[model samples]
Target chain A: MKKLINQPEQIIDEMLDGIVSASPSSVRRLEDTTVLVRKDAPVDGKVALISGGGSGHEPAHAGYIGKGMLDGAVSGEVFTSPTPDQVLEAIKATDSGSGVLLVIKNYSGDVMNFDMAAELAEAEGIETAQVIVRDDIAVDDPENRRGVAGTIYVHKIAGAKAETGASLEEVQATAQKVIDNARTMGVALSPCIMPTSGEPGFELADDEIELGIGIHGEAGIEKRKQMTADEIAAELVERLLPEVDLADQDEVAVMVNGMGATPEMELHVFNRKVQDLLQEKGVKVYDTIVGNFMTSLEMAGCSLTLLKLDDELKELLDAPSHAAAFKK
Target chain B: MQLTVEDTIQWLKQFNDRLSEQKDYLSQLDRAIGDGDHGINMARGFQQVAEGLDGDFDEVSDVLKKTATTVMSKVGGASGPLYGTAFLKMSMECKGKDVDAAVLADMVEAALGGIKQRGKSEEGEKTMIDVWAPVLGTLQEEDFDAERLKQTAEEAMQKTEDMTATKGRASYFKEKSQGHLDPGAVSSYYLFAELADVIGKGA
Candidate 1:
């Protein structure tokens, strides 16, 4: 209620306008759609990498649209799914003669809408392939699960493949590989307030936290008396490391993502513990990213994502990229 | 004859009152399985709906449309959009008529369609639809009574405790959403029952 806004209805639109203005000139917002793309996108023969979801998790789908990450991103209103039309526009806007690869999260609405968009895109002669990221070990659906924080890895890896002039099929295959090897888990200490309503989605006592929560304001798997950051990290890593195919000789890209409200200090503190746990498991950590990559508005929490790397995946992940939120 | 603006305001005021009456219960249900803001969110939305009413409208449906738009714009979160879209669809269906039982019934059906389209929810997903689907079934029957509608809606809301939520945040529970009513669905059912009362007996 005490936020700066001319009107509540205009919040999403206004925010999009601001992002467009502040973003690199290469990044352009497609006409009347919530999709953002590179100005010189679809450079002749490279496969186009596209990703998107609800809007509140800013610096996500949009900010990641740049040189080495996403070729385009479709955005919905806060925590809402973008219509298939919006996603289709993004597909068209970014597709050159080459095909496009869609990196979708596993949420039902997101999956349905993105799939519809892909079908529409393919109908229009734009070859499209899709890879769903369901790396959140927090949920039990092993094969067809909701995409969580591990989506960041897919974005990075696919972006690299596309930048290297990989075919759409190749890029799609790489993204699926990343998805197959990754696992993630999250915990929330406090709920976040949506900017328009100025009300928290849920309430937690000062001494409690929810485990195995989804990104939306939904309830978590369990709520228990609060534990230290180290304990929280241990439990999260325990859940994540088991599902990921990390072996003794495997190199991995580990991401520690903050769930909107948690501060930088906490992320690093949590990262330290995560590093310790991985070391103990003899999992060779090739790369580490600790920041607020994907968020749930202002929810105070974090999720850990681990991607087991083959030589090719590690190279793609290490490819140089420029996006607002990610730096390689 | 169509309803006056005053009648519209009265309905919203009563609706807010109904939300307040069930606020604690809704919050209690939410506390058990999901976020505990359903009661407060519903109350806040209806309160905003009440505040938005002013002057006379030519059609009862227009008033309903305004109410729907008001809640959609003012309320945030899933409840704001879903409930708001439902009412908006219902209002679109009710254009220019006096508030009659059949029209109300049609409005309910329209609202359900809007929810189904927006939420992509099925019958047993343990969302607001669980409460709504049953209530609509009862309302559509010849044996439907105002009291029976109210009672059945509450019963359906309670029945959510037995089903596992397969949508939204509660779905993460996998099976833990069982034994707890969805707070949003419970309040939605209450709102429906209250609207049924206002429309059913012509009180």
Candidate 2:
């Protein structure tokens, strides 16, 4: 209820305006739609990489729209998936001779809208490929899994592949590889307030936390009394490690992502435990990122993403890129 | 009694008014088990449908197609596509014709099929399908009429309070999703109930 904004309905538009103004050199918002495309879009002869979801997860779909990340990002209302027409405009704006690849998260709305967009694009004679990221380890049901922080890995690797003049099939396949190998788990200390509703999604007592929380403030698998940072890290890592099948000497990239309101000091403290836990298991840590790469609007929490690395993935992850949110 | 294009437009207008009035109630329901945006999303979608309805249309199908497009463009949530697809399918069933009771039943069935196909959900999932499926059954009965369909939809919407969610964000709540009315089912009930009211009044 107490936030800096003129009106609730104008938030997405005002935010998109600010994004374009702040990053004029890298991105531009499409006229009359919730799409942000690369400044020099439809990059000749390169497969375009596009991903998006609701608007609250800023510095995600839009911030990654730059040199070697997403070519276009479509945004919906807060915690709402973009409609098919908005997504189709993004596809049309970013599609070059090489086909476009859609990197979608596994939420029901995102999946259905993006699939509908792909169908629309195909009807217009544009080749399109898609990869659905469902890497959240918190949900046991694979059929109903929610994609979390690991989606950034998909954007990075697939964007790198697309920047190298790879075909749509190659980019989609590489994105699928990242989705297959990566796992993510999140914990929320408190729930976030939706701007329009002016009420928190859920309330937790001072002594409690929710484990396996989704990015959209959906309830997690379990709620229990709060644990220490090390205990939380252990629980999250224990749940993630089994799914990725990390072996001895296997190189992995780790990301300790803050959920908007989490501070860097706490994230690093959590990262320290994650590193120690990975080392204890004989998993080689190739690289580490700790920050708010993806966030639920001002929610007090963090998620950990681990991408099992091979030579191809390592190279792609290390490839030089200049996105507003990510740089390497 | 055959339903005309005017009746379809009136149904939409009435649904819009009802949604605007019940927006907070729907959001309250969603806040219990899902992210509390169903009411806001539905209100925004119908506002767009109202704006799009300004143009003249020849038949109920044309009105429905316009509503579908406007809702799909303006409503940016799961309900947007779900309701949009339902309207789109219903439009296909009503192409170039007025809808009598039999045709209305067929259109409702098509709308239910479209929701099932788009959401990849089944009956008993505590979704809008829970209301639409039973209404479809009622519409197929021998004495089917506007009053019967309205009664059946209201009962089904009320029944969702006792069911456990198995699809969409509500499913994430597991057992906690019970004892709360499904927001989507409530909105869908408003849609059908408004349609019946408009038709019964000879709009």
Candidate 3:
């Protein structure tokens, strides 16, 4: 309840205003909407990429809106999906002659609204393609999985592909490839508070933690007594490995993402454990990113995302780009 | 008895009032198993719907189409699309036609069908479908009455308290989702109850 803000209802507008002011060179806010588009949008012949979700997950759909990343991001309220019209506006704003690709997360609202936007855009004689990211391994059913931190990989790889003048089909296919090879799992040490309600969505005992929580402050798959950082890392890694089908000597890129409130020091300590565990399994680590790339509005937790890499993915990962959150 | 366009507007006004009164109660229910935004989202959507109801409407479909677009634009949550789809489908069914008991039944069916298709959810998954599906069945009965339909929706909404969620964010909680009323179902019940009240009085 005690956070820095003016009014609960104006959070999205105020935050977006601040973002455009701070990064005027890279991004601009679309008039009368909660959408941020690249300054040089509607690029002559490149396929545009758009992604967005609720507002609390800062530096996600918006922060990635720059060179070699998303061309536009349509933000919703905290923990809420953007309306179809808002997403459609983003598509229209960012669509160039080539086409547009929507990188949608796997939550029900997000999937439905983005799909609706694509349909709306198509009706208006614009070409549109969509790729839904459902990389969270915690949910067993592919149809019901939630997209987590691994979504950033899709942004990077697919954005890199789109920047290279790849066709919309090529960008979508590459994004799907990332979705197919990537897996993520998260553990939450505390629940998040919604600004409008001014109440924590759930309660966690001082000695307890929740495993496999989504970014929305929903309770996780399991609640148990807290474990050491190493133990938690091992548990999350083991849970992700089988789902991703990693074999000996295979290479993978790792992203240890903080859930807003987790400190960088804790994330690095946790990342070290994950690297050690993968090394123990004879897996080669191509690169490791330990930071708060995606967050859950000051919730205390971390998620580990592993993308099994091919030569194509590695090159895209290394491609130079200028986004506020990720560069190169 | 047939429902006039005026009745349709009244139904929406009543639903908006109900949501305004029960917003906090519904949000409290969501706080237990979901993201705790259902009540706020629905209230915001209905408030916009009320504000946008200034145009002349020839039939119930016109009113419903306006409601659908306004809710879909203003409400930024799962309920927005779900309810928007429901109203959109209902409008498609009721377009340029008078709505009697039989047409009302068809509208309910279409709304329920739209939610199922849009959400990819089923009747027992502890969503708004829990309230909507039973109401659809009641609407199809030979002796269908507004009071009976209202009672059936209320019962179905209450029944969601004992069910574990299998869809949406609540599903993440697994067994812990039980013993809490599904917030979407509760809001849906208010919608149907308000509709029935308006229809019964009009009759």
Candidate 4:
């Protein structure tokens, strides 16, 4: 209710306009669709990399569209998946016969919509491949895991691979490799309010926190008493480290991600324990990124993502990139 | 006995109105175990469908196809593609044909089939499939009873309250998902119930 928007239904449109306005030189919106593409798109012979989901996760699918990130990103309504036609438009607008690689999150809506779009794109003679990122380790079943902040890692690596003039298959393979090696676990102190509904996504008492939450504010695995920054960081790091094999002191690129409304100070506090805990367990931190790379509107929380890195992933991670939300 | 373009528009309009009225109810049902946007999504999609219905259309399939695209483009959720595919399949089945009771049954069957393939789901998953599957049988009957169709859809939707979901995000809840109505099933019930209303009016 306290949002500074004219109307709830216009949030996506207005936000898209604002993003394009801020970075007109880098990104552009596909006409009449909820899609943002790199300003110099269809980069001739390169395979196009497109990734996106709901709109609340800013600096995400759109903000990462530039030279070595994403060729395009389709936005959905708040916490909703982008529809098939919108995705198809992105594919058509950004592909240059090298084919396209769609970096899809492992949610039902995202899977179905992108799958349908791929089918439609293929019917129009556009070759496409997709990698489903199921990096959230909070779920008991691996197949049911939700893609969270770690999806950005896939974008970086895959987009870099594409920029290398790699074939669609090669880009897709690298993207899938990132997906297989990444894991994320999140905790939420407060729920997000959907602008249209003006309703909280979920409820949590002041003394409680929900662990293993998805970016859409879906209820996490369990609710427990709110803990100190160290305890929360310990819980996330412990759960994440076991998923990726670092038993031999393997190196990992760490991302201590804020879930919106959580300031940099708190994330750094959380990352402090994350660093110590990994060091104690003989896991080498290859690199670290701590910020709100992906968010859930104004939800107050944070997640820890671990990307078990090898020589290839590390090189790709360090590659040059430019976008509204990323530069390296 | 066969549906005309006029009749199809009436049917869709009725579906849109019902969804518009029950939007909050469907979302409330979803909040229990799912992301809690079903009512809002369906209502928004159908409102667009209703607005777009003013165009010139010569066949039922044309209207259905347009509605499919509108709902698919506007809904922007799991239900968007699911319902969009359902209508698209139904439109494909009814294309260039008179959609009588038997043909309507086939259309519903085709829609159900599309939903299954699109969602990677099946009956008894506590989804809209539960309602669509049973209602197909009633549509195929020689009697073609409107009341019976509505009752079957309502009963099927009610059955979801006691079952655990094994498909889509609801499946993530496992046992905890039981005792809550599947939001998709409830919205689908409104869809069929409105179809029955259109039939009863002999539109």
Candidate 1 runs further than 4 Å off:
A1-6, A119-125, B1-122, B128-158, B174-203
How do all the candidates rank in terms of lDDT, highest first?
A: 3, 4, 2, 1
Please write out the lDDT profile of model 2 over residues A148-260, one tens digit for every residue. Answer: 89999999999998888888888888999999999999999998889998888888999999998989876677888999999999998898888889777789999999999
Give per-residue lDDT, candidate 2, residue B179: 96
After TM-score superposition, what is the CA distance of residue B32 in candidate 2 from its true location, in Å?
Answer: 1.7
DockQ of each: 0.14, 0.75, 0.79, 0.75
Off by over 4 Å in 2: none
Model 2: CAPRI class: medium
In candidate 1, how many clashes are counted?
A: 1
Summarize candidate 3's per-residue lDDT along A279-321 as a digit string, tens digits.
Answer: 8988899999988887889899999999999989999999988
Per-residue accuracy of model 1 over B108-199 as CA lDDT, tens digit each: 88888888876778878888888778878876787547787788888887788789877765676768778777877777777767656665
Between which residue pairs do clashes occur in model 2?
A: none
TM-score of 1: 0.74
- The candidate, 1 or 3, that scores higher on lDDT is 3
Tell me the spans in candidate 3 whose CA falls farther than 4 Å from its real position.
none
> What TM-score do all the candidates reach, one by one?
0.74, 0.98, 0.98, 0.98
Q: Per-residue CA lDDT of candidate 1, range A1-328, in tens? A: 2566677657767877788788747688777767788878866788888898777786687878777898888877666666577788988988888988889887655665677677778789888889888887767767546688889889988899998888878888899999999888889998876554466666789899988777766667688899999999889888777788565688888899999878999999999999998899888899999888888887889988888999999888878988877866
Residue B65 lDDT (model 2): 94
**How many steric overlaps are in each model, in order?**
1, 0, 0, 0
